[model samples]
Target: MRPPVEVSVLILSLSAPGVFITMNNIPALQEPLPILGMGMVVLGLVLLLLLLTVRNLKKVDPLFYVFAGFSFTCMVFLTNALEQDGFISGFMAFYLKMGEPHLRTAYAVMTSYWEGVVHLLLFLTIIHRMFRGKSYRSLGLLWAGSSSAIIVHIPGVVIGKYGSNIQPAFWRNVPFFLVPFWAASLLFSRPREMPVVTADKIIAEQKKGLLSRPVDLLLSLLLLGAMAFSVFRGFVVLDCPLDACFTYVYQYEPYLKDPVGFPRVMMLVYLFYALPLLTVFIYGLKTPGCSWMLDWTIFLAGAMAQTQWCHIGASLHSRTPFTYRVPADKWWPVITLNVLLAAVPALLALRCHNNPTYFLKPVPEGQTINEKKKN
Candidate 1:
């Protein structure tokens, strides 16, 4: 007999595909077919990856693997239903079909609810492991970040809104800001007795080197660019009037009947934001003792990508006259790449048995490193 988890995942997967097929009908029937098509293509790829992961559940983090598979299934199903039927139709269908509407309202609702569950679980896992023997500093960083997410996210939930209206984009992104904030805090918080070399030791040499002046400068520049773009977008959202000379800027306005330009710009923002994380991952791969970093980074990237994917899929399904620019089929490819990218690190993390140093460092004295490292 198939494992209980596998059987559950299969059921969820099958239910979701039907939703996806239906969701596509909404946007496929709209104009700007290419844009919608690309979106769907990306979405489909993501679902395929999740389905594959379910088939290989033994290789993934039990909590995350299950959540990921279910999350994608929910999204595809919701999107399909929303696109084919109206919002109420899709929402009711998934609610009744999946037997979990109370857990989440719509496909996007399911995605957000599960995503929150996953993050909380990850936070707990990190904390549990850290308490076992890992550094308080790393745990502290995660705690701070996760706590920020809770703070920012709770307001949105309480207010009963999904997107930026509950918490503006700037406020919604505050959790991500915690990473750099914590990094800076480390420099000041390090105990006088702690050696600088140990910090270097924790990270891979390649990453250590990449965090040097030039790389730091590049990161700073990127941050600044992101901030500037955010400010610009914020201003536009606020409806700050433009002078005659700035009339060109108004051409890129976001509140127009057709806001195609806004999404395109937002896509650019996502790409830029993703770059630094990607850079760090590349650096980790080259670092001697930094394999764990690679795993963590991969997990984070996948989670983040999944978050975005959920939003995009939801947006396509909304009843607002706004363009349903993304086609249904496109989502598959994007999700597939995201899963592969994330799985590498997750498998590595599991194989290392939660030991960050297993692949890079020799076993510690008196115990096998992996066993010793278990939380």
Candidate 2:
């Protein structure tokens, strides 16, 4: 049996921060260190603790080891945040220089905060539930999308603006990028947490068109608007010389033109990736049997949440050059637009999850008869 929740919490509390703080105080540790040695020690210790404490750890999903090990590395993320904020120093300077010099960017600092605090807590919750043999598919999918977005834009900025500065330590992100795809496949393979509705109910829900579902109709419109906005910003970043794109890029979201390239790559991600998804979302809303919406919406919601958080925060952060920041006159409008971009997918996900009958597969006439007879 797994340990009680309190025991797990207590163990983590003592292990993660305790080790980090102790190492921070060591003058020798503060010096430049080999990334390989540090990574092995952190992951090895966490894996060792799990082996000793959780008896059934091996019997549980093997992915547990992958996630749990990654979770402890949130300490590195925390270290990044602390070092950036000046609460601690030197520990990560060598690693950042050798691995990802772009870590010094404003967007990366905000990304560190998100990963350290929010994503760390999320991983812990997932680990706790997994320890107890509970379903963590939903959370897994969310993290999959969130992590995928981070991995994409982070690399995009590095290649787009800092290509010359790339280092071997940067290759460490290869696993971080790949793990999400593997975890997502595992999560999607799990049966969905669908309510046990009758065939009749599924048929009735699926029969209704988009207009009949006022909420879905509204959501579809919002998604369309968001799609347009995504493409617009994408063009703005690409230097589309149209009057509106040119004017808006300069006067409104000047951050899109930031030389650092994070915002530019972000908008392109939305355009190329999110735009197609948004189009499919509208189709899912109008059509029946699009059960994929349930998972993808949650996935997109997570992606949008992480993407917009980094984009919005980094754009206005004091670290961003003032000339590239959103103009004061346009701050509210610009923020509102970006906030809506993040929020719409989340709302769509909630809609699909809350009343999934519409997205549930419609029963064939023969199956409905069989089910009726069985009932």
Candidate 3:
């Protein structure tokens, strides 16, 4: 099936020059913006001021300065989103044209809003807590998970669809892609601020069966449903031959079939990564002393929230070709299902956080006696 070497070489030679020319001819391209330099200066000055003036901030993790600086970019994200929607203009004109042509994609627009609103608030909250000498490991992990998901999917889509159009400035995402991993490792290594729960409380909470806890039972069922939905959508995006998949893709979620590749990659992510987590969450709810659920639930909630926000918004946005956008008649049902999918993980995180005794390690009888003797 291989083509002749001469023919293959000829084809590539012919196409490469055109790709370069197209990339260089981006509409509205202008002289490079100073935004990047300005941001670095601003963040550097803020960090220096904090290190000198704020005694509490000096004791905080160094990454706190980085995040505190990154939070300022959230406003830039909001401006980009507004410009993309035509409510404003010129804010991101040069960047969009030369820096990241892929930002024109519907998915990127939604992601911008998410970073601007949700991520901004998260960073500010963590910064405030850090300044007050409070533990913010949970919030930092949430941000880490959310930012990681966004960084992964956005670049995947860019290379998937706009590989030929990539410009030099696109490489600026290198830091964005790398920093989350560092931040995540640092946050995970931090000591958790464990809640005060007596031995009796841990024993009582862990002793209860799943059926005895109505909320947990409901969450288990909802997570099972989410797992199934994730699989079904994975099939839809993969172009399964089943009647349901065919009908669902065309009539309900045409965006899954878009050639842009974001939706397809996103579904695959859900199927491969999220499905296993959902099953484990169900197990965690039913079993006692599943301490991992507390942290993982928050992490999963952040991932699901970020992914669903971008996916749903992209599916409904006007930029999606009319043929690929969700059908008007199916809009409400589709939105409801996707919204609930995103909400289930959030609820699980809340349940684990609010009453974590069930997820805590069971107290050993000998250890409890030793503690009593010490008292």
Candidate 4:
């Protein structure tokens, strides 16, 4: 018999493979129209609940609320995309025949409008977070960087819509817009010099033997590494024209052709995109101090919703065979491995809650006390 843990992992793996699977031999599920409708209803109910609950709840950092709002807006855009692609004949027909000039033009217009809104909101949230506790000098630098990078899209958008102009405006402006945002990220990433809990609180909590320093350090390191990797990759992908070309050639094309390759790329992309939620999960599971579990779960749900987008793009275009449609002998193992990779972090998140030793040792007592006092 499989170990209970292994069995649980396997169950999770199969149950939600589509949520993380990018490229697979399985037939891509059509956008469930009923499910989408139901989801919108549920979202509406949740929003109403949030409005009511927050009024009675403590005033936590407004940044958290801002992030939540951005996340919801992203979901709204995603739902709109789904409705357009799934229910609207004109939109679906246009996307299906992407090579058509008129369709391409329409797609360019609609996609640009939606993407611009999403990016603008996301950028605003990030900027708001950066400026929350920092000086205007720091905020100004970030503003200059993010704004400059975003400005490059203006020419790129124009070029996509109109014929190339004199002096090659968009192409020339791209780098100036990208470089500073990356530079600002590196400049801003300072480790918290203060303790998360107060010195008195730590002493009080220590009496209960609840504080585990090693676990805290390990979780912190994991979160920091994940965040740093994501930001670094974002910079590399955004700033390097060569990286974009390679992505278009290798990752993008394979995604549209090979079913298996689609999931692989998607898994990689989600691993990056989900880093923030993963960090929250790690911290919450390790500490169990705050009520971020709900937030983490919601983020995970949002990530799962996004997997549909990845599969929709590939399935609509690709001619690859579905793995599940193939013989059990051929594709099950590949599916199994992909599922395992996706399940590992979730299991780790759960285990960390009960086993603090899963992470590193606590900071030295004197250091912990000093840090807490400084904070």
Residue 233 of model 4 has an lDDT of 37
Which candidate leads in lDDT? 2
What TM-scores do the predictions have?
A: 0.35, 0.89, 0.84, 0.31
TM-score, structure 4 vs. true? 0.31
Residue 13 Cα positional deviation in candidate 2, in Å, after optimal superposition: 7.5
Cα lDDT tens digits, model 1, 1-375, are 544443444455446545534544554433333434443564466557655635653343332332333344334444444434445443334222322222233323534544445443444454344324444443333333222222223333333333222212123234334443444255225431121133234433324353453543453444344344435544443445756214423332212112322233333333454445545544544455654552344334433444344434444434324333233454464335434433443343343334343125433445443443452
**Candidate 1 TM-score over all chains jointly:** 0.35
Q: Report clashes for each candidate as comma-separated counts.
A: 35, 0, 0, 17
Q: Please tell me which predicted candidate would have the highest TM-score against the true structure.
A: 2
Better of 2 and 4 by lDDT: 2
Can you write out model 4's per-residue Cα lDDT over 1-375, one digit (the tens) per residue? 433322222232232223212212212322233333333454465445435534543553333332333234333333334444453222233212221122122222233334335433443445344435432223223233223323323433344323322222123324335544454444345332232433344444444422455545554565565455444434433334566545532433222223233233343454455666666665554553443342234334323332432333333332234421323343354334334433444444444334332232244455553453445
Candidate 4 Cα deviation (angstroms), residue 140? 24
User: Model 3, 1-375: lDDT tens per residue?
Assistant: 654322322233233223323434554334344434433454566456445444542255687655755565566667678888998754566667656777788888898899878987787677667756778899988998788776546546574677777766666566778888798888877767677677887788888999999999999999999999999999887779999999899889999977777888888889998999999999999988888898889888999999999999999998888998999999999999999999999999999999888988766544542354345
Worst 10 residues of 4 by lDDT: 94-103
Superposed Cα deviation of residue 373, candidate 1 (Å): 5.8
Off by over 4 Å in 3: 1-58, 365-375
